[model samples]
Target: MKWTRAVHHLTDLVEKVSEMPGTHFRFEVVELWVFGDLLGAPRDLEHIDVALVVDLPVDEVPWLTEPLGAEHWANASRVSRNPVMPFWRSAQAPVWNHRIERPALAWSKADGIAEETLVAVGDGTGELVRLPAPEPDELRKRLDDELALSLAALRHDNQVYTDRRWSPGKLTPYADALWRTTTGYLDLLDALAR
Candidate 1:
């Protein structure tokens, strides 16, 4: 599917879910974020990755004995049986493997909601109308932060690669590749800052 269409579908789905009666349970979608290849605006994409930060009211789940235990159990059970579990799993898969090193675009629920937030609303004709993108300064700051993080990871990985006694030579290639990536980010940041 196209990136735009996928985004539209996601927005519609979220809206529908949000409109569902809160009688069964109460929850809030605090934030929605899109990351990975979808941000590149490719012509076609296999899937769009999104992270939804939700707040489920534990007070509603009275069956549990303790509040703290209820919070934990509710979170676990929510993920296990969420209607969009597949998408949720995909969105979180990168976190477990430390692959979400890149920055994400935060999809805001409405204008003036938050900084660096993107909003897309339906036009009532099956098309989506996106709000303005973040300001240049915001974009630059995000890139700068990401570059700093990448550099830190590179330094830490370098230490591990050099200290290991066995197969240290094997790590050299991976280290070099990471160095190249770090430099690429630096170059991109420099260009953006210019």
Candidate 2:
């Protein structure tokens, strides 16, 4: 997917989250962080990873009173009542990974938030770590760096495939796919440079 398209999809998600009624989930998205492969702006992304810091009111889900385990503190620098789980599941209690029809976006229905997207619920206590918003220029530079690294890895693998005397039938398709991805990265870089 093109970087522009991915950005649009992310924007749609944020809009949807912002518009979600507190009554529905008994929580509000206080902070959002987009990371992983989506940050690289690759041509064909596997998925988008978003980390949401949410205010899950104490009155709601009163069972989540204490930290879950030691690992939670090690990773996030804060104790979590539950391990980072799919926000949708928490949103739709008793229905795990539920998909419901809502408004449509460029790539998915309004309810089709990526399954990989996770939420860290904060229960009134100020223990949950809140990260500062990422700067756009820094994120763009990081994307450029990641794209370059990906291109290098692809090129190296293509070279290895050639060295192994892979047949044209096999090599041609792989090379073509790589070329398309390389072109996509270049196109994104050009757009970002503008």
Q: Estimate each model's TM-score.
A: 0.35, 0.29
Task: Put down candidate 2 lDDT per residue, 14-127, tens digits, no spaces.
Answer: 556555544444344444444444433245554444444445432221111211221332233221321222221122222111011111111122344433332211111111
Candidate 1 has its poorest 10 consecutive residues by lDDT at 59-68
lDDT of 1 by residue, 1-194 (tens): 75566555555544544443434443444445545554454456666555544453322111111122323433543432332212221221221112222334343344313222234221221112222345566656645554564556556546766675366357655565456545644664565556
Number of the predicted model whose lDDT against the real structure is largest: 1
For all candidates in order, the CA lDDT equals: 0.41, 0.38
Instruction: Find the candidate with the highest TM-score and give its number.
Output: 1
The segments of candidate 2 whose C-alpha lies over 4 angstroms from its true place after superposition are 57-194
**Global CA lDDT of candidate 1, please?**
0.41
Error of 2 at 91 (Å): 16
